[model samples]
Target: MATQEEHPLIAEYRRFSPGSETLAERSTAVFPGGDTRSSAHYGPYPLVMDHGSGCHITDVDGHELLDFMNNFTSLIHGHAHPAVVAAVKEQASKGSAYAATSLNQIELAELIVERVPSIEQLRFTSSGTEGTLMAIRCARAATGRQKIMKMEGGYHGSYELAEVSLVPDPNERGSLDAPVSLPIDKSFPESVLRDTVICPYNEPERAEALIDTHAQDVAAVIVEPVLGSMGMLPASHEFLAALRRATERHGIVLIFDEVITLRLGDGGAQSVYGVIPDLTCMGKIIGGGLPVGGVGGKRELMQLFSPSQENPVMHASTFSGNALTMAAGKAAMEAYTGDEVKRINALGERLREGCNHAFQQAGIKGQALGMGSLTNLHIASNGVLHDARDSIAGMIAAGHIPRLLHLCMLRRGVASASRLMFCVSTAMGESEIEQAITALHESLAELGPYVASERPLLVA
Candidate 1:
């Protein structure tokens, strides 16, 4: 167990991040929990970042760390890439937002449509949240169905509809074959819960069965190719194929929420998997580290939004395709070619291998699981996890090990999500990968005795 001196997690957090402590305390007066994003918070506080350049972030305390967070995987090229900076600066001088369309927006859309084969046409929104919402609404409008089928523990966004059945309690999650649709919060209306059908992840037979059962009422089945918020769990090819077959057979729209997974490859996870959806929701890196979202698919489906006459689904955002974001996005996308994608993915593989080797060498039972350029560390003796329930159980059994390990990595000049998922960027090289591996070695050493004592199950 952690010694009495280290029992107070908050104290250790403050000792490592004193500046963040002060900043968090001050910010709490305005923002809830001293932070705006719920996913970014830590035990005591988060590092108050001043600025970032390339793959490094300098915090207010003058600590420079390799930025694996990458603004939640949005900055594929990392911070302040010269091309993106030039584009943003140039666009800023011209104008920021205008209700009218601009050439920059058209150019950006053209690039996206050209790269992603599924996207014959596209429309932009202000966020991934809005992108998923718009896709769901479009599906509903086209099919005239009400209910939506989402994977159990799949997170689309913050909205009530997208968040249905996100964090099911262990006891109430129901059988693996027949998952229950549980509300994420009380704010979700009973009708919303009723309108959602939860399917177990990576379970092809169960997914097909559930889709078949709910086919009459379900307008769409939305899923992340790689479950982002739930420990970077990648869906099996069989499961995704099953969804495609079932959705097609049932006349339901299949929507792949590639908001995070878009960074995986040239055509996104859909391209990698060779299974295209009826509608694709995208965000994150596509905007060049700015706020942007898009839904694209076959022209027949996407044309539902045609403003030529009465658009079926009403969609408009004041900043949907603002000039600045378009400029930056175009620059960023231009820089990211097939070669760049392969390089970053190779880096991610190296990171995973190094972390896994470290765990094995330390006689700790854990696994680094993910795909392409993203990876997540889960402390479990059960090997790689297939779904969110497995991830949640691993986290609960590991106690505070992952959290402490995260803090330990930060102190060692490495930064990742609090959950320990690290993403590789174009800015990172062999040196960054080695540094991350060394940090993992050091962090596991620091927490070794505690896991051996209190969490023997993790090391068993």
Candidate 2:
């Protein structure tokens, strides 16, 4: 048994992080919970970041730590890369937003269209949320269908339609054969819920059956190739193939929500699986650490957005394709190449391997799961998980251990998502990966006894 003061769990989190705590208090006066994003929050408080350079972020508390959150996987090249910084600085003087089109927007779009095979035409939006919204609307318009299909645990954005059936209770989620659409929040209208058909992830036969059953009314089937919010669960190639075949047979627009997963590779997750969707919703890395989103697809489907076309789907955003974000995105994308993507993805694999080793050494039932440059830590020893239900169960069983582990890592000069999902950046190298591994080892050792004692359920 460890002494109270000597316990690594309690001892490691005692450092003064006043800058973050103080700023959090001040922010609470205006923003709920002193933060805008619920995913970024952690117990005791999150670090108030002052600035970031390369893979390091300096918190207002003056503590320097390696950043793995990467602004929720938006900073593909890491903070303020020379190219992006120079572009933004140069473009800021030229003008940020203009009612008219700009050359930078055209260049960025051309780059994306050239890289993503399925996207022959594309349009920019202010956020991934908007990009998804537009994709759904376009699907509806193109097919004249009202219903949509989405994975039970897949998250697209904040809209009611996109968020439907996101967090279904096990009791209400129906069986694996036929899933039920469970509302994520009460704010969702009954009509929206009724229009969404929920399908299980990684279950190809079940998904195909569901899509076939609803083919006539379903306009689109939106999925994240790698489910980001649900611990980065990658969809099986068979599952995605089933979707492609079913949607093609039924004339349903298949949408890939790569908003977060776009950073995975040069061609994105689509390239990895060799399965292409009719429409791809993208954001994050494309913005170069700025706010931006996009929806792109085959020229035929994208032509529905043409202003010159009669009764085109209406879409507009004051900040969409703003010159500043466009310039930064162009610079960032230019800096990233196929080789760079492969290198960063290799680093992510290293991080995951190190984390798995740490869990084994600590005699804990935890595992790191993810693909390419994105990864997440699951506090379970149950091998691999296929869906969100398994992820939630692992988290629930861990009690406060996961949160405590996050705090411990922060104090040890490392930062990952509060939920323990992390992504590698181009700015990070082997040294940073090793630092994260060392921190994980220390945090696990710190929390080991408690997990073995109080959270006995977590022990394998």
lDDT of each: 0.88, 0.88
Q: Deviation in angstroms for 124 in model 2? A: 0.4
Which stretches of model 1 miss by more than 4 angstroms?
A: 1-10
User: In candidate 2, which residue pairs get closer than 3 Å at backbone N, Cα or C atoms, i.e. clash?
Assistant: 365-380
lDDT of 2 by residue, 295-396 (tens): 999999999999999999999889999999999999999888999999999999999999999988888889999998999998865477988777766766
TM-score (all chains, Cα) for each model = 0.97, 0.96
Q: What C-alpha RMSD separates each model from the true structure? A: 2.0, 2.7
Question: The CA-based lDDT of model 1 is what?
Answer: 0.88
lDDT of 1 by residue, 1-460 (tens): 1245665444566777778778887889899878898988876578999999999999999999999999889999999999999999998999898877888889889988988868989998889999999999889988999999998889888798788768789988889888878887678788888898889899999899999998999999999999887889999999999999999999999999999998888989999999999999988898999998889898888878887747568897788988888888889988999999999999999998999999988878887999989998888743768988888888778888888888888999999999888999999998899999999998888778878887888884
Top-TM-score structure, candidate number: 1
TM-score of 2: 0.96
